[model samples]
Target: MSVDEFCRFCHKNLKIKGVFSQSTKIFEKTSNAKTVFDRLIDLGLTLKRSPEKSIRTCRRCTSILSRIERDLPVFRKWEEEEKQSDSSEQASAPKAADQSNWDPPASKMPRRVLHKFWPNPPAPNQTRISMSARRSITEVMTHYPSSKTVCNVCHPDDAGIVNNISKKNWKTAAGLMMRHKDLVEEIKVKILELVQHECKTLCNPSQGFILWRSSPEDLKSFSFSSLESDLNRLSPFLLSIFSTATNHSLPSTCAAAAIAVRGREPRMSAFSYYLNSILLHGGARKAVFKKLSKMAITTTHCHAVGKLKEFPHTCGEGLQLLEVQKEVLPTSGADGLTDSAGQDDEGIDLGGAIGTHRQRDSQLKHDLVDSSGSQAGQMCQEKRQKRRQEQSTQEEEGAEWVSRKRLRSEVQPSPLRLVVDCSFDSLMMFKDVRKLHKQIQRCYAENRRTLHPVQFYLTSLGGQLKQNMDETDKGWVNWKDITIKTEHYHEVIPREELVYLTSDSPNVLTELDDTKAYVIGGLVDHNHHKGISFERAKELGIQHAQLPLESFVKMNSRKVLAVNHVFEIILAYMEMGDWQEAFFTVLSQRNGAVPVDQNGQAVEDKEDDDSDRESDGTNTVKDNTSSMPDQQEGANEQIEAK
Candidate 1:
C-alpha cells in the first residue's frame, strides 16, 4: 500500500509523529481489531523473505503514515521541534506508576504547537493542489487504473503540463518533478497489437516487425542493420517514439503514456511519423531508454518488397488511444483496439487487443549440408576464380558464339481474351465508378497500348455512361484497338459465357485454358458495394473464380481490391504463370499471405502454401529465380481470334 493508504483506509489524522512507534503500539495492543500488519500477514504475504515494498499497510488500520519524504517541505523543522520537546520536557522527568501505564494522547497538541508541527505545511489557500503526485506515478497507478486518474495525480495540470514537461534542478526549492520512465519497449508492443488488429482493414496487410534496443555490437539480435539495409526498399508505416530532451528523463515521477506524433523521415525514409509520450518509472524500471541510439523505437512493415508504402499521418492519435483504451477495458485480442469513436475513423489497421503472441518464423529457409567434401568444394571454387582471372589476363579469347535462341522462342497464341464486365457500373458509388473509368483507361495505356499480347474487350457497358466514361470515345479507347459494347456479357459470348472473378469466390482458378474467356468486373468499390459481381455471376450460371488472394496472401483489410489492381495481377499471372509470383508482384507489401524478412528470405509459416495442395498437383512451394525463366517460356501465350 502507498504511504497515504495506511490501512487501505485513510485515518485522515490531522497530525502524526513517530510513525513506526505508533504502528507497533497499535498492533501490540489490539485484540478484537485486526492490525494492518496482522492483516498483511494473514493474506499470505509474508511467505517471501523480503517485504512487498509496493504494499505495506493493511485495509483496517488507521494511518500515522505521511507523504513521501520529498513531498513534505517543513519535514526537518517538524522532526526537530518534536526532538527538542522530547529532550527538554520528558527525558529529565520520571513518570509516576499511573502515568507510566497511560499512553500519550494521539495528535493532541495545541493549535499553536500543531501549526508549528503540521504534517503538510499550509500553502496560500488554493482549492486544488498543482504539483507532481504526492506519491510516485506508478504507485498512484496501482491504486487507480484509469488514465484520467493517473494523469490527474501525476500531471495535476490539464492544459500544458502533461504535454510539455521540462526537467527542473534536483537541488531547486520545488525539487524535481520529471522522472525517467521509458515507454519505448511497452509502446512498441502496443503498436504491433494495434497494427495486427487493423490488418484486416488494409488492402494488403504486410508482415510487420517490432525492433527494440539495438546496439551496434549486437545488430543481428533485433535485425537493426537489416532494417537499415532495406530501409529504402520499405513501403511501410514507421512510428518512432522519442523524448525531445537528452536520453534520460526524470525517474519515479508522473510520466505520460501517450504523447505527440510528428512526421517520420530520418529513420525508415517513409512518409510516417513518431509518437512522443511520457513514461512513468517504477521500482526497477530504468525509466531511461537503455540505449541512447534507441531512445526512440519504431514499428513498421518488415523489409518492404511490395507497392503499398504509405501510412497516413492523420492516424497518430488513434493509434495511441488504442493502447490507453485496452488497459481500461481489457478484452480478447480479436476485439478491435478502439475508443468509443470506432476503428474505421482511425485508419489504424489494428484490430484485436494487445499481448497475443503471433509466431515469427523465417519464410525463407535453406538446408545446410556438412560433409568431408568441403575441402574439395573450396578447391573447386578457387580453381574457378583462378581460371576467370587467367582469362581476363589473356590478350585474345575464342570467338563469341551467337545462338538463335531468341528467334526460336516463339510465344504460342491462345483465343482466351479477357473480357471486362461493365454491367455493375451503377452498383458502385459515383466516385468508385469514376475511379474505375480512370483506372481502366490507365491500365491499358501502361501495359498494352500497342500490339498488346493480352486482348482487352469492354462488354455490358450501359448507354447512360458518364461524360468521360461515355461509350463514344475516350483517351485509350479512342486511340487503340480496344473493344467497347453495350451488350450483356452472356449475349456477347456463348461457350464459356462469363468466367467471373471476385475476392470472396470459393473456387480458385488453378489453370488458364485456351478457348475460355475470363471476365473481370470493371468496378472499383472504394467503400460501397460488396459481392455485387459474385452474386451477379452466380445468378447468371457463369463460372465464378476469385483471384486466389486467400491462397497467396493474407490481407489486413478485406481482400477486395481495385479494378486496376486485379487486372494487373491477371496480366502478370499470364506472363509468369505463377500465382505466388503474380500475387507478390501486384499486391501491396502489406498483404500477409507470405512475408519476406529483411534478407528477402521467406518467413516460414507451417500452414502456408506447402500445407495446401491444388487439385491439379501443382506444388505451391516457392523456388529459386533461375528456375522461373524456364517456366515462363511455356506459360507465355496470347489470346487471338478462335
Candidate 2:
C-alpha cells in the first residue's frame, strides 16, 4: 500500500536500456499495480535508470541485488562485450528454419551472461513478497499501532521519533516474547473497554465538571469569573441538587450541578440575599433562621455604625430601605420611577422625566429626588448617612442616661455574714491572712457606718479548746434574719467555734456558721497543725476552719490531734534553737512532741533529745519555779534522767 509493490507485466522480459525506455514501459501499463510501482519509485524504493532520470527501489530488496552486483562491478563493459559478441555471431549465422519460433539456447551464453539476462521469478508464495516484508517488519516491531512505521519515507530514528513507548506496547512486547499474541490482544481490548466505560460515565455535565476541574490543564482553561456568574445564574441548580441530596455527597453534587448550570442568568449577591432571607423567615425556619441571624449579628455588631458615615452612598441606600420602608415597599409606587401617565409600552422617558424635575421651582424637591429616579430610591441612598449621625447623637444621650440610672440603683445593704475560727498555728502560715482580716474589719466598719451592700461580724477561737462542734456548726451556713437573732451569742466572742460574722452596725450581729476556711502552716516547717479534719468535716464532723491542701491530705492521713503533736515538736524545736534537726524531722513526719513539765516547759527526755540540745553550745533557758512547778520539774527531771 505504501508503494513497495510492482505489476507483473512491468518486470516481464523487458531489458531496461535507458531512462526513456523505462518511462515508456511504465506509461504503457494500466494496472493498479503499475501505479503502485511508480509511487514506489517516487518514494525511493525503486532505482532510477540514468543521471537524467530518477528511479527508486526498496532498500531491503535492493540489498539482495547488490550482493549479485558486487560479483560484477563492470556492468557497462559486460553489456558492451555481450553486444559485440551478439553482433559477430548474428552476422555469421545461417538462417534458421523459422527465426520467429526459434528460442535462444542457454548453453550459447556465458554463465555471467546467463545469470545477468535470465530473470528468476520468485515462487508463488514469494510472489507477494512485499506484503510479507511489511508483515516481517511489523512482526519485529511487536505490531504496536504505531503512528508511523519504518518505510521509504522515514527511518527508525526519524525526526519525529520519541522515546515514549506505549505502556500497552510494553506488555505486548513481553507477550510477544512469551509467544502469547492472543493474550496480548485480549488484554488490550479489556483496557480499552474500561477506558471507554469511564469516559462515557463521566461525560455528563455534572461529572464532566469534576473531570475538567481536577485536571490542571483543564482548570487552567476554565474561567473563574464565568464560574461565579454561573453560580449566581444557576442558583436553582444548586437548590435542586441540595434538595435532592440528603447525605454526605450533597456538597459535591451541589457544587458540580451548580457549575454545570452556571452563567445562565444575571447575578444576585449571595451574602446579601442569604442575610435578608434569614431575617425574614427566621420565625418559621427557626434553626436555619437562627443560624443566619447569629452570623448577621456577629458581622454587624463589630461594624461601627458611626464609620458608615465615611461611605455615605452605601450606608444611605441601606438606611432608606430598612428605616423608610420598614422593609415593606408599596406594590406599585415604591420605586418612584413610574410616570404619572403610567405603563408606557416603550418604557418611561427617563431622560425627559429627569429634565422636567430639574425645571421644578423648589431646591428642596430636587434634594428629595435626584436625577436617578423616585423619592424612594433617593431616600434609600441617604438612609445610611442619617443612621450614622443619629447613632452618634443617641450614644451621647445614652451615656448620660446610664449614669443617672446607676446613681438611683445604688448597692443595697447586705444582710449575710461570714466567719472563720482558724486554729492559731494553722492560721499563721500565710502572710496575707492578717491583711485579709484587716480588710474584712475595715469593710465591716464601713458597712456599720454607711449601711452598704454588705455587713460583717468577725470572731475566732482565742485559745486551744477541744469542744464538740454542734450540728448547726457542721457544714451549715445561715442566711436568714430570724436565725441571725438566735445565733447571736456575743458581739464578738471566741467560743472555740469557727465563725464568720457581718455587722450592719456595731450593735447588729450576723454570726456566719459553717464557712470554708483555708489554713497555711508556718513557712519554715509544715508538719505541725491540728486543724479540723477536711475529710471528716465533709461528712458533717466539725467544719474545717482552713482548706486542707491536697498535698497535705494525700501525704498525711493521721488524726488532726496527732498532726498537732508533730506541730508542737516543731514549735518547741524552733524555740530550743534546734531548727536544723527539726527541719529533717518535720520533712519526714518523724518528729515527736518534747516532754513538758506541768508549767508547759519543754524538757529533754532521753539521749536523742539531749544529744540534739547539747550539739549546739547554747545554754537552755531556765524559768522561775513555783511550788507546783518545782514538784513537776522534779518529776520531769526523773523522766529525762530515765
Q: Model 2 reaches what TM-score against the true structure?
A: 0.18
Runs in model 1 deviating more than 4 A are 1-414, 446-452, 463-466, 470-473, 495-497, 590-642
Candidate 1 lDDT, 313-346, residue by residue in tens: 2233322322231111111111221124443334
**Maximum-TM-score candidate:** 1
For each predicted model, how many residue pairs clash, with residues at least 3 apart or on different chains? 39, 32
Query: Cα RMSD (Å) between model 1 and the true structure?
Result: 27.7
Cα-based lDDT for every prediction: 0.43, 0.33
Per-prediction RMSD in angstroms? 27.7, 33.2
By lDDT, the best candidate is 1
